[model samples]
Target: MDVTSDEVEMETAPVSADELVEAMRQAADDAGFDLEPEQLEVARRLGSLAVGEASVPAHLYLWGAAGRGKTWLLDAYFQALPTERKRRVHFHSFFRALHRSIHEHRTAAAEAARATGEPGAGARAAAGAVANAVDRAVEDLLDEVDLVLFDEFHVHDPGDGTLMIRLLEALFSRDVSLITSSNYPPSGLLPDPVYHHIFEPGIAVIEANMTVVELAGDTDHRRSSAVQRRQGFSRGTWMLTGQEADDELADLGLPRPDAADAVTMAISGHEFRASAARGGVLWFTSAELLERPTSVGDYLAWAAEYDRWVLDALPAPEHLTREARARFVHLIDALCDLDVELHVIAATDRETFMTAETLGRGGFARDAFRTRSRLALLRTVG
Candidate 1:
């Protein structure tokens, strides 16, 4: 991923982060959005830092309320950058892949050691194996990318929080530049005060490694944009959980899922049972979709095939486990990304759904925030 000097010069010549952001402001205005002063300030700072040609580029942590254009700004900066060794990814997907790679390496090493019939791969040896595996995995995962742009970064699970420290340390060691957008500030991450200390190391690393820019605008750009450009996303419903939900289904000419005739789909040679399937429409319960250890890959596969999805009985996150909440976020993200016509039936109404107790708790906030932000674009009918 070579950063051609000519290209760099063209983008960074004299244009500062401030200037670039101002340009973005004008563009937004042209698109009927009045950019806030705070957004412009943050963008200016980001633009200036982004032009550095140092070996280890300065990193940035952009944080603010949801829908303040943090992602929009970072996206513009990412595209304008002259480097070919850049990757922009959703934080959840990136970490999932990271964990998967580490697990694969560690498991393979352990299996190989066991198969070799060698004695004394004891606890200490196992620890060493894990460390070595992590090193290799980090290297492999970041082999070519010099700049990684993570959208909606947050840590809730202790395992993920702990891993963040290691990941930050590893990335710093390799001099990899990072640009992440989040709804939390450096001090505000992992906001559960009881578990906040668990991520101290990661937080410290972030503070030392990146410049923090807070985008504290009052308006949510996505919500406003949705209202202004509220087309394309249509045929959605916010229905009641039981009888009314069934009635809505009937109104839409959808059949009730039969227990005796469950529909199943296969992905990667593994069978995944669905509540119901008809034509290209699929039905799933919140429990089946979120309670299971489903990956984004599963949703991606389904999204590719299904034109319509009916997610029924979404229990407000209180009853859901942490993993379930995370999966729900991933599910919504996948469907939104694929632009699937989504019809949902929940115990609660749309107003209360986004700010549910579970969504506001722990690291789920960022994902929930993003889910809600994207949901704003969706057309809703009661």
Candidate 2:
């Protein structure tokens, strides 16, 4: 089926639910996803939602293993939805922007409280200010957005569980519908036993308000796939550090920094050690990146500034601190989301680098599954 841009735009203009399913089928083909039975079921359900079918729930929570096509199905359907009032956000950048905006609102609110010239005014206003900050931030972030698609959603961090609850509440209050994909089911989120109970209320809201579906397929699709694209992360490679990796870098005419080329640069109020910038390429060792407290926002900032990134001297995952391992996962996530070219050099094979023992505790197991799947797109040199 040859779909013209005009036809796509026409489809987007308030199609019937039946017509929208046809549009969604076209979207799946365009996205190059082989629609499994489970995926098709979810996609059809999501398509039915474009027209707000009365029988359809207001929100959807699709959960599955990383390679089960949860993200692909949701994204493809989102593109085909017949509405301009929709927003799609990746979890990392979405949370980063949310945190930043809430902080900005709270600062302004606190300043106003201070200027009132009343004793304990700032202290007294802090509670209400937080609520206002959340409301204002959500209002700004989701202006006229009736539908939101949240990709790669997870609440692994204990500290973030509360934040997620607040965000869900805000979205509910505004009557904004949501479609989200996640590696874990609602009960499996924030898997830290100590903090699991704290998210129960949030889970209850989801259970009450959203339709939950599991896309359970046997295949690890990413692991079985080969690189078919010449741009973006698909064009990248994973290789053991050696002359072979260096030769490929030279063949691609990409930058590879020597010790003398490394330098420290400040970005987004955080310092990062990188190779001397060459055109749009930047290089850093795993230690320089993962050993520090660099945030997902910092990775996003760097990925934005540099089109290509080279990561070298990646140690075994077992050797790194849990924090460092988590940082690497976030780094891969940000880079993959932006489709930034990344060349990673590791000391061992991907399997050995991501052993069960290496991933340790918390929600790292599932999160690592996602990171590993993304890396599987990279060309591997044994």
Candidates' TM-scores?
Answer: 0.76, 0.88
- Model 1, C-alpha of 93: deviation from truth (Å): 1.8
Local distance difference test, each candidate: 0.70, 0.75
Using TM-score as the measure, the top candidate is: 2
Clash totals for all candidate models: 4, 0
Instruction: Look at candidate 1 and tell me the lDDT of residue 7.
Output: 15
Which residues of candidate 2, in runs, are more than 4 Å off? 1-12, 30-34, 50-57, 111-128, 356-366
**Candidate 1 lDDT over residue span 160-261, tens digit each:** 787788777887787677788888888888877789999998999999988888888778776676555433223555676777678777877776777975
Best lDDT goes to which candidate? 2
